[model samples]
Target chain A: MRISVDSDRCVGAGQCVLSAPEVFDQDAEGLVTALTFAPDPGERDAVRQAVELCPSHAITVHDHGQGHSQGRDHDHGQGREDGRGHDGVVVDDG
Target chain B: MTGAQPRVVDFPLRRPGEPFPPPRYDDYRRHPGLVLSYLPNGNRVWLVTRHEDVRAVLTNKKISSNPDHTGFPNISDTMGVPRQEQIPGWFVGLDSPEHDRFRKALIPEFTVRRVREMRPAIERIVEERIDALLAGGRTADLVADFALPVPSLVISTLLGVPPADREFFESRTRTLVAIRASTDRQRDTATKELLRYINRLVAIKEKWPGNDLISRLLATGTLSAQEMSGVLMLLLIAGHETTANNIALGVVTLLLNPAWVGDGRVVEETLRYHSVADLVSLRVAVEDVEVSGQLIRAGEGIIPLVAAANHDAEVFTCPHAFDPARTERHHVAFGYGVHQCLGQNLVRVEMEIAYRRLFERIPGLELAVPVEELPFKHDGVLCGLHELPVRW
Candidate 1:
């Protein structure tokens, strides 16, 4: 599994770190950082939960093994990202 | 159903029982979309219930938190106005870019690391209050004696407010957090006094800079003296009131269900179960926004009921119960999106230490009065006990 975080979208609420501290940590300013981009399979549930729970919809994950790579946040879209498929992997610049 | 006068409901939905968020909300959650509701000011607002819809409303950038917005619900006259957007450092009610400017300058001071550094002090302070509580006798008002002081002193220590003036601010803030319990004049008086006091502190900090939030922010020169005062007012008031209320609520709720105490998740569960500050997350549609299949037109107020979202049965089973063992811990008690509670990490550490230490150190700690006799702050934006008589 591969993980990525959008620092710009991050509001530093710290949910990511709290939920998946092993895989995520916040900087001095509180924006999240992935401690290890590729978290162990054991940490996948935590990572997935963190992605789902982030208040800003800031974190995203790409699970290569199961083609799993989406968050409940983006799935709803809320008209922010046009044509963004829920099942499709979301890759953005930053 | 066509002409049913839009189903008017109280915006904050005045507290109903042992723990609040108004049970009327449970029915609102089952409805298809945002239910039309009326505020204390008799203004219209779309009540956003359900975990999914609340999160959507929070994350939607088009929605504005600025209280001055035309569509913003008029809640200020009752629950202390959110200080206008023109107020330089009143970022609580400002939108992004502007809000980001202030938050960026302040986030470092409140990050997990900075808050963690204060752990020893928090622990010491909690212990000291408990010591004082014990000294005062087995029975006393835990709200004032223990819960209030721990966060009040901690925030004072952080903002560089001198101990001499702590009482002045604490009293004013107590009036500030009340819902309908306090008259508009009382809240206004408190707000003015706090701002005036903070402005004076800014002048003092300028001449004698110290190692604290006010001194540090002023030294950065990012915000002016007046602006810094605005920020400090927010920090000082928000920093203590909500956390203090949570501390008291956490204590009382745990006393009601002692088995929930000692467990680490009690803090989170308390925050969720008794969603104090539920009504503070008010916003308006700056542009038309869709939530829960309904089109919320521009210039309409929105209340993303934090308490309702926390208690959404879809997310939390048997939502009303205080179950720390619940799997989904993602409650919106601190709100969501860009304006998420800046002091949350600090609040968490304070609560964690307060609960853990209070239960551990005070062996026989339990309520002095029965649960029904307790004074709950049902009429305010922040839900908390007015006083918790307890005996240890």
Candidate 2:
């Protein structure tokens, strides 16, 4: 899974770092910083929970789903819910 | 959705000490959509109760939290006209731009990193308070000796109340909360003195800065001195009891659920479960908006009940029960969107330290009064304990 954080959108509540410290860290200003661009599969659940818990929706995830378009689409407002499953970016076979 | 008129219930049905958001909160959520409710003064409002709907109402820019708005739900007549006139920097009662200005100036001070750095200091405060609490006696009111002071001192530290002035700050805050008996005149004096002290603190931070909240806020230069004072006052006063009550209720909650006492999930669950400021998120819709298949027209009062939403059965299984092991659900307890509680990280850390330390140090601690007789503050903006009597 891929992860990203928007410093501009961050409210500094720190839910992301609190929920998934292995993958995310806050910058000196307290905005979120992605410690790793891609996290181990074991860390996916924690990252997903961080995205869900983020008050500002500052975190986004993209699963390596079916040959899909890949663009750094952080715009268009609340880009986290970009068609991937709300729980995670996993695509369904059905 | 056919032929269902918005159901009516008394808005803010006050069932104090009954665990706020009472069972009736379910009545609104159980309905397919928002309900029409009336405030005590007969003002009609749209009460958003479902978890998703509450999140929507808070996040939507069309909603206004400003008290001066045409449709804003004024809880009391006293809060009506004079609110816009008097209070300047209380951002909790403000909307964007005006609210954003204060939030922008103060956000850096409350970042997760800043609060993380504060953990050790917070732990020290908790330890000192616990040491004092234990030394006082085996039997004492936990609220008076423990719950209240821990947060009060921590907040003072955050606000740059130096150790020398800590006693003065505590006494004034205690007076403000009526934890100590004082006449209205005395309470008024306490308010003036605290404000005066805050002004002095701001001046000191301006001249000789330190690594504290007030100093950092002055460094921002984004807020005027008046606005700076307003924001600090809001943080000191508004930020105090919410955590204190959380600690008080968290103590009672943990005592009842001893096995789950020290778990980290317990903190998040406690926040969601009690949702102390149940109806604090009141708003007015600025533009037409649709929520859960219902349309909220502009200039209409609205209340997105956080307590009710936190307990929504759809999001949280067995909604009313406090189960740390229950799959944690993201709750709107600190609220959602631009106006989400800025001090959430601080509150989280304080509770974590307060609960873990208190229980670890005093393993034999238990409630002094029966559950039925405990004093719960049911009839206020904050639903918390009036006093938490306990024994070691």
Candidate 3:
């Protein structure tokens, strides 16, 4: 599984870094960025916690077989039932 | 949705001779510690109305602001909303760790140095509004003309949004905070629109980084897209709305009590007496804690009534009266303890400039309408007059 951050929703609260320092780091302005991580089953819970703990509710994860667009598109306002997503950006799922 | 006893309640009963139904500080002092009150829903809450008790409750880490604990009322509980769903969650709602992180990150922008740098610009905005009010000629509404615009402009500038968006943000904020949005659809639509607007702005800032706070936020790698959006929403609500009400109500308080303006210490007293934010953002019981003699269990909600606390007779002499020299800094106007407002010093500077410039420039600014008829959104989170009509 791989973790991803929807930059649009990140508020840089730094909770993610506190929860999983191996996965995240905060920039000067307090926005969150993902760090290098070798995906492992043991880390799913950590990633999930980061996702849930985000005050901005801005993190998501996708498994290797699952297409990034398929698994996490529901978030970031993308792939909704109404089909409009993050800042109205339409995802092109082929 | 659960009908548990409200962790806290407002009895609506006030002592005799008080302007509002709730009793003044003196009444609470006669019966100190915690005052039990009831909400219409029948939730029993412990209201700490005295300065000592309010301070005790606020500083105690045992008092958690988080809502996950069943006994703790949601921060939005005052409005009676449940935790699973909330209107663009505010940072103030989070307990330590998350709360500390968000607040600390935003601290730089709200610092005295940073806020003071905006003073010239703030003064300019204040002057322009005052000028327009004068040009409009007699009977201008202070709320719209002076109070609202000052903080709205400051916050907009901080976010790099056009000042023109003030009307939209203001109306949206009113709907979110007002009691009239009885239907879920209405509330949802407002929340959705606000989220949509902030989302779009966040997107734009990502592409073209402006010098505003949003751009600074975009550059930070610490937050995810969703978190960034949440922060924007939080800033929109806390950064401007609260200050606007403070400015409006504070002005009204001074106008209603003319003697206040002349007092050598009107600034401090005005902040204490007519503090615009009636309640500090609610905090949850992090753990079982005791204030004075009462024990509040972990997860229970404790609302420190700053207005009531400011007037708590035990803390101050003649707590009900608007005395200019109360000789106390116990006022919870900006709240107390670890989360006391980061923007407070800036608020003081803004208020000082606002009052000083108004009196100095207008010379004899006074209310044009009777205090009773003045428009006040009675049920708003930040209680203040809708339109403070005033004339020179």
- The DockQ leader among the candidates is 1
Q: Tell me how each candidate scores on DockQ against the true complex.
A: 0.45, 0.40, 0.02
- Candidate number 1, chain A TM-score: 0.73
> Could you tell me which 10 consecutive residues in candidate 2 chain A have the lowest summed lDDT?
A68-77
- For all candidates in order, the CA lDDT equals 0.79, 0.79, 0.62
* Model 1 steric clash total: 1
DockQ of 1: 0.45
Q: What are the per-residue Cα lDDT tens digits for candidate 3 across B7-61? A: 3334433323345415544465456456666544455456777775666666565
Models 1 onward score TM values of 0.89, 0.90, 0.70
Please write out the lDDT profile of model 2 over residues B255-358, one tens digit for every residue. Answer: 99898977988888899999987767888888877777777789888888899999988899998888988886698888887778889989989999999998
Q: Candidate 3 falls in which docking quality class?
A: incorrect
Which stretch of 10 consecutive residues in model 2 chain B shows the poorest summed lDDT? Answer: B77-86
Error of 1 at B114 (Å): 1.2
Model 3: CA > 4 A from native: A1-94, B1-21, B74-89, B163-191, B259-264
Shift of residue B237 alpha carbon in model 1, Å: 1.8
Winner on lDDT (1 vs 3):
1
